[model samples]
Target: MGRVVAIANQKGGVGKTTTAVNLGASLAVAEQRVLLIDLDPQGNASTGVGCAPGSVVRSSYQVLLGEVAVEDAVLETELPHLHVIPSTPDLAAAERELFGDEDWATRFRDAIASIRMQYDFILVDCPPSLGTLTINALTAADLVVVPLQCEYYALEGLSQLTNTIERVRNGLNPGLTIHGVVLTMFDPRNNLANDVAAEVRRHFHVYETVIPRNIRLAEAPSHGKPVILYDAASRGSYQYLNLAREILDALPIQAA
Candidate 1:
């Protein structure tokens, strides 16, 4: 079965989507089959992997609404082993519609269950909020990857996020666990960035690999490509690949 990981954080601009796109692509480059599910209505993950948001016919919206199977909504990305379940603006309505149903939180979990065996990893890119959609993502995921930007006030919202995860583990998904925290947009030159990293490290054992604030990462999305494909030689691309390797190393391998 595939490992479902939700890349989530309530705070925006923390490189959550960036990590989802690049890490998925890098893993694919390493011959790991990856499914990138765009749960965020913004659909940045869809566009980041070269799928046009407007052109996406079937998306996570349909999957969440029970209108289609997740496999039917899957789209091939430019990367060989990377597939995407795109998202559209219509996904915003899912939260309200789902609220009317009793099994709202388990909807996504049920949807993904059928297709869990199709890939090595399934990554859900959640919106920057603790709304119903995010809750659904949390309920469905086996593990959560929280991405924090290296800056002041970055840890301010973490306690709330941790509390939410605890609730999900206790009430919804008992198997849910935090995979790890990633430090993003790190600037080695900035003393504040250094302090923020130290503070975050002090509080949480973060992923050793910190993603630098590289222009290549910001520029790749505009070109409808992940940094791994857009600028493979760039430092950001290398860092993400290394991050993927670290993630893989951290996982316990199943006996053959």
Candidate 2:
């Protein structure tokens, strides 16, 4: 079975969606069959991967609502071995609709279980809050990859997130584990960014590869392409490719 990883953090603009998109694309480029699931209602991951918001006939909304199977909602991306379960704005309503349902938390887990063996990796881009949708993603994931922006306030909400993860591990998915914390938008010139990196490393034993603040990363999505495809020679592309390799290294070896 594929490793199901949720790229999540309750904090917004920490490069969660960007990491999910670029990492998934890089993994695909490395010959891994990858599925990028957009669980965030904002649908940034969908657009980042070049899927137009209204163009998708089926999406995660339908899957969450039980209107369609998760596999049926998956769309093939331009990248070979890369597929996406796009998200639409309608997914926002799923939070309220599933709130009182007894199986609300496990809905995504059940949905993903059906298609777990079809890919090498399943990356879930979660919403920017600790709402029902994020909870669902957490319940469904085997590991969580948190993207932390290198800034002064980056650690402010980490305690809350850790507590939430603890709750999920204890009450929902007992096998859920933290993959590792990734430092995003790092600027070596900025003393604050350096301090943030050091602090995160000290507290969380963050991943060694830190994604620098590169314009290429920001521009890639506008061109409807991943950094690797947009500018393979650029620092951003090389960094994300390395990130993909690091992810594979961190995983348990299994025969392909």
Question: By lDDT, who's the top model here?
Answer: 1
lDDT (Cα, 0-100) at 193 in candidate 1: 80
lDDT tens digits, residues 1-256, model 2?
A: 8888999899999999999999999999989999999999999999988997689899998998899988899988889899999999999999889978999999999988989889999999999999899899999999999999987678886767888988999999999988889988888899998888888788785887889888999998888788888889988888889999998988886664
How does candidate 2 fare on TM-score?
0.97
Q: On residues 182-251, what C-alpha lDDT tens digit does candidate 1 reach at each position?
A: 9898878999988888887777768988898899989999999999889999999999999999999999
Model 1 TM-score, all chains together? 0.97
TM-scores, all models, native as reference: 0.97, 0.97
Measured by C-alpha RMSD in angstroms, how accurate is candidate 2?
1.1
Candidates' lDDT values, in order? 0.91, 0.89
Off by over 4 Å in 2: none
RMSD of each: 1.1, 1.1
